[model samples]
Target: MNKPIKAVSFAAAAVLAVTICTFLIIRQTHEDVLSKEAVIKKVEASYEGKVTKSTQSKDKKTYEMTLENPKGTYFLKADATSADILSMNRVKAMNPSVMTEKEAEHLALKRVPGTVKKRTHKNRVATYIIQKEDGKTYEVKVDMQTKTVLSADQISNKDQQKTPITKKEAKTIAERETGGTADDADLEESEGTLIFEVDVDLPDDKEATVKINAYTGKVANIVYED
Candidate 1:
């Protein structure tokens, strides 16, 4: 072929290859979009509250929404294309201190390697259920905020340890010491330590407050309110 004809032929071949690749890429992307749409529909159905507004950012490639009726806001990566209940709430709440799944898992292992009974997430915060060597079960709440441990408490096995005088044990001892009824009101954590806090209603028309260390199974503080 002549030089000009040869050049034309090469250009045509290049265009054909480019067109083919572009078609395949567009087709695959369309399939992915369909799959994501299905998942998003499922999320919307499962949500009890309403989504008020949805917006997409061109620069950041993020999809943000205002969830109303319940008063919430959410943000998601445009590429994620799917909404989860917890993610939606977390984004809406904009709680910068919330913990990620990985962060929570790492903290749990550090606290008690083999004693992690279960771990779950709600609204971006990680919750841990752990058991001590003494066969006591405690709920540990980690605040995603500040990446700190929030609270810890012993809800079961209050009678595991045998005290010399169980009935006469000091209120502080009962709250701090392992194997005693520490009210088990609720647990919170801070920094890296777990805190067990409880409020007890006594029969004598009085109330007691209790706190404990979840890691060492020791009581931290106790208070009586009449």
Candidate 2:
């Protein structure tokens, strides 16, 4: 009886240790995710030019901003303890196109190919919220002028002359190196240094994370969304 009790106690202690370590690792990973999201939101605001609408995460460490004028949207991450530049100057320019709300929705749908959750339009440019099969949402931008999609997928900053990295290459790199799936990874971009980012799917249906790396295909970090 003594021996059985000791074995059970040891097992419980081992389980508790694993649980504590997992909790700490997850907390640290979550912070990394928030930090990267902040950088992305800052860069996006700089390019799109405004924070017309904003949403704050429950923890108050993340923000999602919708831009005015040309109408782009971005998600921002901020630290409760650390202050970061969450603002950018607006660019004065003509709206991409003068579009009716309905027209804008149609255009946005064409690009993202999903049910419209919400939409906003100014002049001819319109932005729409589309949900992926995973239930994750992505903002889509449509150009009424060219009937073109201006969402994150299309706005990659790679050289106009250089062929963009295909989805396969991205997957192969992630698999061989990071041991992460590449299905959702798209060729985002790298400046000075080659960089790419892939959104990682977590266990939850609607939650996901992002992974970024250098051009040599070295992964920098993995970022999670709550």
Candidate 3:
């Protein structure tokens, strides 16, 4: 009797061990993430540009990719297993066509969740300023042609006031910073950061663009054209 019982116990232990190993193997297979090539192809099919850079997370659960097209440079995060888009945002944009007020308003509400109060357009981007009943103000920038949102920012009460720096002062600061001859500067505002973009002349027919803060007269950026 003891011999038979010992044999049955041994058989039960073997069966349990086999079941655990199979379960682990199945789980690992199910959790396997997609390859980098597969994720890139998935994004290219939906977006216009090819993936220029891709990085997988440490856990291999998601991929962050950078892509460039005529429209803009976009950053996208996608699920590694499902190849589903987790998030996408354009980091930079090229010139887009002018969008109408009606269209801009429609697009603005989708991101801002407020009633459109006023609209403005500059640099080929349309901005719809919205006001919520709670007295919160939001600014939404839309790419007029693509109808995609470039950014959505909330405006603090302090930003509603006029900027302190004058146009002439902005040009002077930009010229001083770049040490080049400045032309008429254009005042531009985004995400509550006001800037005066000045095109300046250098020697030998070269040109440089200088961007200065409109409020603080601080130099923001300068780019040289070859």
Task: Give candidate 3's TM-score.
Answer: 0.33
Q: The CA-based lDDT of model 3 is what?
A: 0.81
Cα lDDT of model 3 by residue, 1-226, tens digit: 6999999999999999999999997789556888999989989988878899999998678999998888899999999998999999999987866667677778889877866656678765888767666656777898877778999988865675454577778778877887788878887764545578889988788899988866457788889998
Best by TM-score: 3
Arranged by TM-score with the best first, the candidates are: 3, 1, 2
The reply for model 1, stretches above 4 Å from the true place, is 35-40, 56-62, 69-71, 77-226
In order of appearance, the predictions have TM-scores of: 0.31, 0.27, 0.33
**What's the CA RMSD for each of the models?**
17.7, 33.7, 20.0
lDDT of each: 0.56, 0.54, 0.81
* lDDT, model 1, position 26: 74
Candidate 1 lDDT over residue span 1-226, tens digit each: 8999999999999999999999998776555442444444554566544555555455323455554434355443333343443344445443364566778767765665447756777774678877666555667777675676676766544432322223223344554433334453454553434455666556556667766554454566767776
Candidate 2 per-residue C-alpha lDDT over 84-121 given as tens digits, one digit per residue, 9 for 90 to 100: 54554434445455455677677676666655554667
Q: Could you tell me the lDDT of residue 200 within candidate 1?
A: 59
- Candidate 2: residue 171 lDDT (0-100): 60
How much is the lDDT of residue 147 in candidate 2?
66
